[model samples]
Structure formats: structure tokens, C-alpha cells
Target: MRERIVVTGAAGFIGSNLCKMLLQEGYSVVAIDNLLAGTLENLPEGVDFKKVDVCDSDFSRYVEGAIAVFHLAARNCLDDCAKNPVDTARINVMGTANVLQACVEYKVPHVIYSDTSAEYEGINMFPSKIDSVKPMSIYACSKRSGALMAEGFKNYYGLNISTVRYFNVYGPAQDWRRVIPPVMSAFTIKLLQGESPFIYGTGEKRRDFIHVDDINRFHLMLIREKLIQGGTYNLGSGEDYSILEIFEKIESEICSGIKPIFKPELSGEAFRTLADISETCKTGWTPQVTLEAGIKSFVAYTRERLRLG
Candidate 1:
């Protein structure tokens, strides 16, 4: 019999991609999402889906008989988390606790948790490592709390839970509010209308942008290999590039006529973020796609989607 896996937030970008991979690998998938930050359109075809929030009381019952659980649901908006820390904690922190409790009760053998790079904040360290997390925002703090909760469950209940901290993941189905997608969207829209797109923060800040396909691939590799237990790994390209460089690459690739107008920095935005993927590399996985290639593919995807609609 194929192993049963439960993926929370299965309608979100990463979750949907993971679910598609799981189905392709011949695993039975139970995909549950509240459609709060995820949508039905994002989910892959021919999978079991439930429109239920992770924080709901019935969530525990859904975990019964599952072999493993992949918890990815969270309030991803940093600005919203800053505005309402209570809601952030309720969904990210408490909701994670609920999942952990269910995993324990259901006798699920393993739980893979998806953490974020936001947790590696305030430290002046370049290529931040997994062990050096100093959360600066409410979203980061909430996620860190969930990581600690996973650790706690491992210590007490001996539940095999591992975490993967994702860097700036950009590819198809990324939320438009995120940096890369918004920039691409703005540029594409302006190019058609003969206008210029704006850039924030002088474009000096650097980020370690990993292709979502690579991220999903590495995650599946981790699960199949079962390398780590109760530890965290960073999933990234182990390469960093300035925002200006990325913009120039995009402009050269897609929009050459329109110049970017610089704007003031956004509040609560990290100035620099790079991932140290030594741990992930130990798992025999490395990013196979280049930024330029991924961006081109993403642009084509969006363009085709628009044309179809």
C-alpha cells in the first residue's frame, strides 16, 4: 500500500507543488487548506482536498491513519503579522501546536515542517545558518516558536519531525505581493502600457532567491532519504545576488525600454538575506535551475495564463 501523507496548506504555492510531487511519486495525499492564504485553483488535479483551517477543532481527526504529516500552513504576511501579533500567534504558533498534537495522537511517524528565512533576522551574519536564528518580525517569531514546539515534541514524544527553512522562493504561482512576482508583474503590465516600473530601497539589498522547483525537489529528497531527525535544514542555492543585479537581468531579458524608478524602502523589510545551505547539501541535493532560467519560465507561465484567461 502507498504511504498516506497529509499536507496542510496544500493549496498554497509550495504546498501545491509538494502535493503534485507526492502524487507523482505514488503517495496518497490528503491536502487541506482553508483558502485563507491559499486557493483551490493553486491545488493540483486528482488529489483529496479539504477546505478546513488548521486551527479548527476537527483538524486532529483528519490526521488519523496518516503515515506522515507536512505542516506548511501559516500567516505568511509580515505586515499583517506586525499589525495583529495575536492573529499571527494564533495561526502560526497555536495552529502548529494543534498539528503536532494530532501527529502524536495519530501515531504519524514523521512530520516535516516548513520554516522561513525571516527567522534568521537581526544578525549581521552573511549566509545565515540554520542554528543561528534571531527572529525580528512577528511572523519570524511565530515560526521560530513553531520550530521550538516541534523540537519539544521530539524531545517529549519522540516524534520524528524535521524542518526546512526556505529562502526567498520565487517561481510559478508565487503570491503577487512578494518581491520577484510583483516586480515581474509590474514590469510586464507597464511594458504593455508603455510605462516604467518602480523599485524600492535603491535595489542594493541582497537576497538568496531559490527557485521553487528546486526547493520542492530538495524537500522530497529529504523525505525519501530520511537523513535528519529533529533538526532543521536550509534550502537555498547558496548564492546571493543584489536586487539591482536581478532587476538588470530581468530588464535585459524582458523589458529593455522601460527604466526602473527607485522608491523609498518599505518598513520591516530585511536589508540582506543569504542562506547557508551546508546542511541541505549534505542531503545530496543542490539547486539545478538558474535565476535567469527560472525567471524566463515564470514570465512565460504568467503570460500564457493571462492569454488563456
Candidate 2:
């Protein structure tokens, strides 16, 4: 019999991708999402979707007979968390606790958690690793707290657990407000309208952008192969690109005539982020998409979505 997998945030960008991969691999998937930051249209047809939040869902019912539970649901929006820290905590922290409780009660064989590089805030270090994490924002703090809870559950309840700290993930279905999407969208919108593309704060801030496809592959490979157990690994490409560099790539490809206008930098945004995935590298998983390729793919997706090209 095929092992059943319970995936929270199944309607989300990465979650839907992971669910699709799992289904392709012939695993039965019970996907649950509250549609907070995800859309029902994002998930593939035939997925077992429950329109309930992790905090409110009867998670045990989903985890029952499932061999693994992949917890990916969270508030996810940094700006939203900054605006309403309490609500963010309730959903991210409390919701995670609920999921963990369900996993423990159901005796799920393994749990794979989705953590974030934002958790390592207030640190001035390059190539941040798993051991070095200092959450800065309420969202990051909540995620860190959830990670600790996972650890406790593993130690006390004997639930196998692993967490992956994902760096900047960009691809299709990304929200328009996010950095990459907005940049691409704004540029395309302005270019077709014959206006200058805008840049934020001289556009020097660098970030490690990993394609979501790589992340999806990593989740399936890690869970299926069991290369990691009770450990945390960073999922990134280990390559850093600046905001200016990304803009330049997009403009050069789509609209070379238009220049970029500078704007003040946004507060609370990470100035730089680089992931050192040496731990996951040992497991033979590395990001395959280059930043240039990723930017092009995002531009193409956005163009099609907006009917700009």
C-alpha cells in the first residue's frame, strides 16, 4: 500500500507544487488549506482539499493513516505580521502547535516543516546556516517558536521531524506585492505604457532567490529518501543577486529602452541574504536554476498572466 501524506497549505504556491509532486509519485495526499494566502484555483484537480485553517481543522483526521505530515501553513506575510503581530502569532505559532498535536496524536511517522530565512534576523552574516538563527519580525519569531515546538514534539513524543529554512523563492503564482513579482509586473506595466521602471533604494540589496520548482523537488526527494531525520537544513541556491541586477536582467530582456527610477528603501526588508546549503548538499540536493533563468521564467509567467506579451 502507498503511504499517505498530509500536506497543510496545499493550495499555496509551494504547497500546491509539493502536492502535485507527491501525487505524481503515486502517494495519496490529503491537502488542507484555509485559503488565507492561497487560492483554490492554485491546487491541481483531484487533490483532497479541506477548506479549513490548520488551527480550526481536525488535523488528526487528515493525518490518520498518513505516513508523513508536511506543515507549510502560516501567516507568511511579513508586512501583515508587522501590522498585526498578535493575529500573526495566533495563526503561525498557535496553528503550528495544532498541527504538531495532530501529528503526535496520530503517530505520524515523520514531519517536514517549512521554516524561513527571515527567522535569522538581526544577524550581519553571509551564507547563514541552520545553527545561526535569530528571528527579527513577529512572523519570524512565530516560525522559530513553531520550530522549537517541533523539536519538543520530536523529543517528547518520539515524532520524527525535520525543518527546512527556505531562502527567497520566486516563480509562478507568487503574490504581486512580493519583490520579484512587483518588479516584473511594474516593469512590464510601465514599459507597455511607455514609462520608466522604478527601483527601490538604489537597488543594491542582495538576496538568494531559489526557484520554487527546486524547493518542490527537494521536499519530495527528502521525504521519500529519508536522507534527513530530526534535523534542519537550509534550502537555497547559495547564489546572491542584487535588486538592481534583477531589474537589469528583466529590462534587458523585455524593455531595454526604459530606465529605472529610484525610490526610498522599504523598512523592515532584509538588506542581504545568502544561504549555505552545505547540510542539504551532503544529501545530494542542490538548486539547479540560476538567478538569471529564474528572473526570465518569472517575467514570462507574469507576462502571460497580465497579457502584456
- C-alpha RMSD values across all candidates: 2.0, 2.3
Candidate 2 least-lDDT 10 residues:
176-185
Q: Which portions of model 2 miss their true places by more than 4 Å? A: 177-197
**Please, what's the RMSD in Å of model 1?**
2.0
Q: Over the stretch 196-271, how does candidate 2's per-residue lDDT look in tens digits?
A: 8777787899878788889988887777786566689898899888888877777777765888889888778888
Whole-model lDDT per candidate: 0.83, 0.82
Off by over 4 Å in 1: 177-195
TM-score of each: 0.94, 0.92
